[model samples]
Target: MRTTDLQLASALGAWRRPGVALARALADAVGGAALDGRLRVGSPLPAERRAAAALGVSRGTLTAALDILRVEGWVDTRHGSGSTLRLPPEAAMRLAPVSAVGEDGAIDLRSAVPAAPHTAYQQALLRAAERSGPVLAESGETGPGLPALRSLIAGRYTEEGLVTRPEQILITSGARAALALLTAHLRPRAAAVEIPAYPAVLAGFRASGTRLAGFRVAADGWDLDQLHDAFRAAAGGVAYLVPDFQNPTGALMPDAARRTVARLAERYRVTVMADETMRDLDLRPAPSPLERIPRAVLVGSAAKTVWGGLRVGWIRGTAALVGELACHPLCEPLSAAPTQQLVAAELLRDPARVLDHRRTALRRQRDHLSGLLAGDSRWRFTVPPGGLALWLRLTDVRSDVVAAQSSAYGLELSPGQSFAADATCAHHLRLPYTSPITTLDRVAAVLDAACGGQGQGPRVPGPGR
Candidate 1:
């Protein structure tokens, strides 16, 4: 076929489907094959004018399609070089899941989700509904969250000696949203993240279009020196730290490191955003670094401790900064769902009643999974003393490929690369032990099939075990 005909044929396939937008369809079509491969090494793509004429799309629409491909890292365009595929089209698709996994169904260990159905949660919901009269019309002292919930969150900090005020609290849609708001305001020239951090956080940063640097968090501890170096390199960019039961690695920042980070931030005049989303949910209560180190932004969410659908999180900082964050542009939907805030408020009001069932269930799940994965030869992990997940480092295989293949066996896995600042995780996976025993056993069986029998793994049971 003539080159012109090939271009026309490709464009035809892209826009032939009805209902689906032409640009998106074009992306889905060329995204998996030709355009993806040709963009990698300064290879020339068909001239825009030629492609547009052949495909019968407006030049503007063709430009939009190329722009979409650029954002997704499929094609690199130059003034003279046209476009070059950065990686194989297949590699681009590798980033997307083959199928969607649901909450009520599937053995999904891809996220460190809190197990559901605790009596405490139902009781909290019931109490909130009883007091729902005031919140029906969205009338409240605090805009996004109920005053009581803010007070409760503030009180927790007060116990740690950080004099906090309810007015300084800005409840957000979720932990991810809270971070995005902060990133919007603190649009620094550059930013830093821990290598193998949370994937969602990584996604947020990408969406925000911020320059990023990455530092390693070691098994022994966070590389404090690397953190200091990163800050120094960025001058005064914001640094995101998950100090308590960190998402993917489950490495709790030590007290000394916390103090050291605070000191460095003060010296360098940089702001630290401490993520405490997984704090109180640990099996053993560990002291939070935010309470000890006052030089940072403290972010918390009920999702990890309670349920993912709660849609409530708070950013705690100096009263002045917190006030600014509350009125930030992102609060447009009027500060989270009112009913959800009301529910969180009721749950905070009676902690013991709301947390009793969750604590028991989490402990049981964590213990059972740890026991099952223990003695397995292919995986190794430092089973977290108190959280919903275990961070396992693969012995020899590449975890990214392994996770990609897991879906075929009815297992959903989170490859460590998803959390890295650079797309490079090949030896790690975050396994949330939130599955029931039977489900966990099934996961173990899959692991066995995937990685040869009784893989040499550590089954750690501390405190709860």
Candidate 2:
């Protein structure tokens, strides 16, 4: 796990800030990379001389930066070997559940996952327990997934206008696992991805050595011409999309755009991997892209709609492709825990009721947060019809600087650059509305203080619980 000088330099993008010290900026960039999972633990850094040359810095400056990292527990240097990336215990805890309140009660808006529906979940758990006797008798290994669960997932697609069978479904630990398995199976030379996508997905593609051909996704929606151009450029490669209430941005692609994307994918002979993890969280009516592109492999997860703890997700593809993935070397022999699968099945049996409850709660939170930010002239954002977060455009402040300053106000934020394929969205910030109304109320105050609000402005009324 040795990092090349070039690789290290690329990972440490735009480290030179105007007022920040050179060494501190370099160290902070390295630490940010570690937090973003771009630099894996135990990966030795390139030699000091090579790194200095790659970054166009003097050896002394590079040494000072390494010293900073060492003190912060982001790096460990042995006598012979160079510094290796690492995360201190406290820093590691930041990667835990997104719902976790940080030390001293810091508000973390890093992830867009919602709080679970406790009543529905408890009822489902009770049903799962009742059904566990028969499942317990069999060997715990259910390769493709529990038969009932797979059938339910397949039926979901069938109802959505994509004809599917149980054989077309392959359950995985989570949506991330499903993506990893697809990446390994496809083995594409390159991939066409949205400019600002889910960070983990970008990191996974980069780690796999896949050349990324990024296309811009504006706040409004996708640029079809650019998408077509990217598809033509990366012909025979893979195209990863989040067309249903896209993450971070929450822009839903219209049916016309879906047809265009499907046609472009076909013309270019490219493989499409459509992630629909956020589909069920729709705050409004939207058409499914699966209706237009039957060849595309669909990925869905219970993590967002149900509970992240469930860790259940599935891939919907052709029967033959599903069989191949089930037998892939990287595929886990069993899916998520048997009990969790049963719970998911029970919930899926009457998904509308569960989803209605979730949508109502989310809609309230989303509107409350939107109202709070709407009064602030410095911030501008469109209220997305559906999705868990608001992608905000800061008029006069850099998102990274705002995020750093927000920390002083007991807030944790993911700067927009983290979502970019090449680390370039400095003017944006993603604010999730998954927190309680009380917490979201505090968010307005925190941001106001952090950004130095011009005046009190007109405060919007909070949505009552």
- Best TM-score goes to which candidate? 2
The candidate that achieves the highest lDDT relative to the unseen native structure? 2
Clashes of each: 14, 0
Q: Judged by lDDT against the true structure, how good is candidate 1?
A: 0.68
Clashing pairs in 2: none
* Predicted candidate 2 versus true structure: per-residue lDDT over 1-465, tens digit per residue: 799999988877656644457898788778767765667777999999999999999999999999999997889999987788987643532322334233235777787776566667787889999989988998877788999999998997888778789999998888988998899998888889997899999989988989888888865899887888889877998999998878888988877888888888999988999999988777865533434455788898988887787788899988899999988887764367777888889988888866776786678668777876775778889888777889999989999999998777677789999999878889899988876544566677677766775735323222221
Per-candidate RMSD vs. true structure?
Answer: 21.0, 19.0
Runs in model 2 deviating more than 4 A are 1-104, 285-292, 455-465
Candidate 1 lands at a TM-score of 0.71
lDDT of 1 by residue, 1-465 (tens): 123435445533423333456786566455544432322233456778888777788888788888888876667777866775455322321211112213234456676675333455676689889988877765543554667778888887887678788877788878887888888888877777888788778777777787778888844568877888877765687888888777777777778888888887787777888898877765664433344556688888888766777788888888788777767766645366777888888766666533554565567657767776776558788767566678888898888767766666667788887888888667988777665443455566566555644454223112111
TM-scores, all candidates, are: 0.71, 0.75
